[model samples]
Target: MIFNIENSDVKVEIPALKHYSSDLLSFNINKLEVNYTGNSNPSIPACVQCSHPAKPMPDSYIYYFEVKINSINSTRPSIVIGFTDESFMLNKVIGSSRKSFGLRSDGKLIHTAVQTMDYCPKFTQNDIIGCGIAFISQKIFFTRNGILIGKAFDFTENFPMFASATLSSPQDSVLFNFVGPFGFKLDEVLADEKKVFNNQVQEEKVDCRNIFYLVKEYLEYEGYPDTLQALEEHMDLKKTEPSNSGVISECYKSLDSSCQNCETQGKICNFCTKKIIETVEAKTNIQIPEPRNHYNSISLSSLYLKNTDFLKNPSKNSSEHNTKNLKQRGILRQIIITGNIKEAIKYLTEFFPEMLNDELCMLYLTMQEFIELIKSREIYKALDFGREKLAKFRNYTVYYRKNYDIPISVSHAFGIIAYKNPHESPLAAFLTWAQLDLTADLVNNRIMMRTQRPRSCLERVFKHFLCMENLYQETSFVKIF
Candidate 1:
């Protein structure tokens, strides 16, 4: 990949070598390498120099640089390696702003003033720590030698970054290598990158960068510039343009607060508005268990069943009372694929005669053959459809459809098939065990009123905050995320 110096067409601009903290620190970047040379005092730090033309960081890509900490005058957050945008300055510390992130030698991540050790790795003299940033996940990672430590920082906003570093004492120095064992192992990160960009899998861990610095690296490695031109026409990571602080903060706050209640947690919903915009279908096979009979007086189940108050103080109708009485006779059980789908349907029809009018639903139910479910009902056939299929279904669907919006909403109709036992998953207890009785009670509530859609506590807080308007757009608010 070496190019002849005489005919080299590449335009390289290395950072102008200089000291930021007076004559306290010094470094050299000659011969296409960076090394801390000297230090006069420990008061100031040798930080960013003039614009050093480096490859544009990918919207999400991992590039490792070797950091051989040659000396340490003070072990107090001295040497640092990080990423910075065009705003990086020669007179300022490496990570002293929202746009800059630096990994300190003491195993902490610093963004301007904020420092955190949430995921920093140990760095010592001559230890080649691998440094990388994932914009999609808004995470920065470090690896000692070839081992990944963990994500170090959760960055706040998006910025086109370049590999950067700084030193305190003159003896406190570092060397950066962009080639070969780029400090970090490329193979280890390849799968994640592919999953994020190529395979297009819905994963939260994927690093998403709008720019493909890796592509430029490859072109430079292979000595091809023509491909680089064509690459610009394709999808550029810049299109993702990191949202403003207010927007980004709101999103992160929403996620942080709801992480516990989120069924998927950090497993899904990483992209901004991507999953929110897409609609996926839900499927289930297990039939809803009959409502459990209320025997115990102080039981939570009994309380849920008998409670008539809903929304405001709406009164119950005779039909609603009748439905409640019928529901009381039935007991809720986990939906089983092997169980009878007709049984659940029969219960529904008897309790809510209004469902009988839905010709489409009745047609699908009668046509579904549970021969395989019949097999599954046996210990051998009781497949882990709930664990395997339904979980993935929820990951895709996120939430259940309130009403049948599609022509074929077989999601509710859970049984019978021609060739297979059942295509739909059985209504296992895991899927609706805690829900069937409650949903049944809600349905049977005598009060007639519009039910509100469920909203997470995080959503309430975030929306409440977002609703307020400020003329200056700088009204201070408590920073949570």
Candidate 2:
């Protein structure tokens, strides 16, 4: 008996092998013929024949036929034969050549000289010697008399087959064994782990600056001292005034007596003469005796004594002083109180020397307070200080324009102040000026009259502030987006 395998649509002859029914003979089978003819099964039939009719064969004497199974669209197929043990000696022809047996005459199995090749049709007689022996025993085993080769016949031929087999398996253990780290070295594993560890360490080493620390340092360096003792110590008493009419008259008489020679000579009095001599000496790199200014001396002495008295008796005011003396004392106190302004200006100049201009005094004060407020987180106090300082300096713009040869306009000054102190309410007025399109209007008007270019410091400052604000807004927008 022979079995046939065929496609549903195509009918073509396939090669096969055959064995006799009585176990008397075996023969090479030719191609089994087939026809489609629109048949439902579309199969080919295998043929078997026996040369001797007198031989009585047992029902166990089964015929075998080789059937070729091929992949779809393939012209050839791997061949395997099915049979019963009666026609073939299971042990005698187990693993022999195609024309020989791998069995000794004593009915025991023996080795045969036959080599297996991948995808080759070279089969020995032992290849089919034990084809159906396992069927009777109901146990599958590889025999020395049988060819039990897998798809691979050698090491090189096994590689691609093993790889594809691994990929097709559903078991994880099989996959790991075949495709994962089955052959990795210990050093390679350690190196990879080290690389990952180093990357994590690098990520952890980044330094972030603390905003609080920056604010604290700025405040300590730039903020005004809270106590009045520092200011009192730094103030010069000689530049101050006395507090009473008797004291004032006494000081004037003293000056008049010391300045008599200057008056008699018709030269500038000793008071004015002393100022000239100091100025000339400073200019000429000369040193001379300090000239007398008796009124200045008496005023300085009285002011020093009064300041000491105030320190000794905080409850007392200078009651004997006249209005003029009181006014002089007030000016002196203001200078003393604000003496640190000069020091603050010096410190600020170290960082931004352009801010050393006298016009920027209020700016300096506000910046100092800003540093303090940030350090303390006293938001409301800072805001109030900023408002007061900005209001005070708002008029300095006009004063600067009137006093300086530089042709800065009030509008430009406002713009500069607004740019510097954007948090202040007065900055709104400056922003309004910037938004008026006045700069272009002025330029157009100047061109019409063919005037020289106007100074544009304020406009430039305003534009710079606007550009900074735009950049900040753009960066923030990108983060949000």
Candidate 3:
């Protein structure tokens, strides 16, 4: 049956009863509902098992299925809902086999006949029994009528298991729900788990000072080792000093409360509402004392370089060669940002002439030049530039397509000339200041590739955190700190 997963975009098809043992079973046309057709015999029980196990989610999520007991034999009332591995014997009920687990009508949780225990209360006709496996933990849990019944069994080994149900009497009829709008509150359960996990994380003592070293490594990786000593001194001061300001008034307490939950917690507060105070302090000559903490008081401006002044006037601690390279790159960046593609290319040709050999960089410069020409309304010049430079690289455009947007951008840039007012065109995005800024960034990255590592240590750290956050979110619906 095809259906969507709760709280996720994924859609899955569960294997239905297509080829089950024919002796005592009758399946409906859709093959999702099954009924026992054999005589009511206490000794003989019929079970329908899926050939393949439920498909597991790549990430950490509970994979499970549910069964709605539509009708049951009033005399025996014996229906078993659960999962079984490949080793399971199709002739017997699921829990009777060594590699299977099931919840019976008598309120007993059974993992093989040898391992049985009274778990939750008995489930009967019209009741929905949800059985799921938390893949990461390798545990089975059951839910009864939208409420969770605790974990049933912890498996010692991983096995591919499929959903199965056994019927003891002829009157037994069941409907399987694989992908759901399940009766259980799966989203809420996941959210609660996440909430608990986050609370646990919050209670644990995390030395956020590790972030200080991450920043230091990032700055050094980006060629700013001299900034480390200054950063370390500032961090030490922040740790030692307390807030200099007096107690906040009742009216200002709300602002203080808002800052406490800022997204930039443990980093510089760039978009925090509390930065309003700093704006006021900077605009007026008023001195507003703030607590020397990481989140509220510090802004991004205080932490890193906003411009290339550091390259122009290098610190005594910096190497002369590195300073010279940075200064050249800064000039190239400025030239590109100012929309002077010709000047930037000339500057590159004079100093970093080898960079011209890199076709991707050349394509970017060519595209930028075309944009500049278009902006000046030199349509024929732009067309000529495209034919001479951009058109020649069409064969290799596919090769550069993966790493850069230049291929699609080249087409879009050319399309801009079709309009008398290019600004009104759908491809007008290529005309924006943001596009110029991106071109400058790409050129800057191209330069960095020759001189330094492509990605910064800070970017790797954030990516690592993001990966961990995703893993946490897979099991728990909410994000952990």
RMSD to true structure for each model, in Å: 25.2, 32.4, 14.9
Residue 168's lDDT in candidate 2: 9
Off by over 4 Å in 2: 1-245, 256-305, 313-359, 362-409, 412-481
Residues 1-481 of candidate 3 have per-residue lDDT tens digits of 9666686766655567646657788888888898888874454787787655865533325676789989986655379888888777767877887788898887888776877789887767899999887654457889999889978888877678888898878778999887677888666445554565567677888678657656754553344423643575467623322221222211233234345433333322323323433443243222222434532233322222322333344444344465555534544554565675766687788778989988778877788788888888999998888888788765543212223444463554466778999878766767776676677667767766766554665787789989977766775534322
| Candidate number with the higher lDDT (1 or 3) | 3
Q: What's model 1's TM-score?
A: 0.35
Q: Best lDDT goes to which candidate?
A: 3
Candidate with the greatest TM-score versus the true structure: 3
TM-score of each: 0.35, 0.14, 0.53
Residue 210, candidate 3: Cα error in Å is 6.4
Q: What is the lDDT ranking, best to worst?
A: 3, 1, 2
lDDT of each: 0.42, 0.28, 0.65
Model 1, poorest ten-residue lDDT window? Answer: 279-288
Output the lDDT of residue 276, model 2: 31
lDDT of 2: 0.28
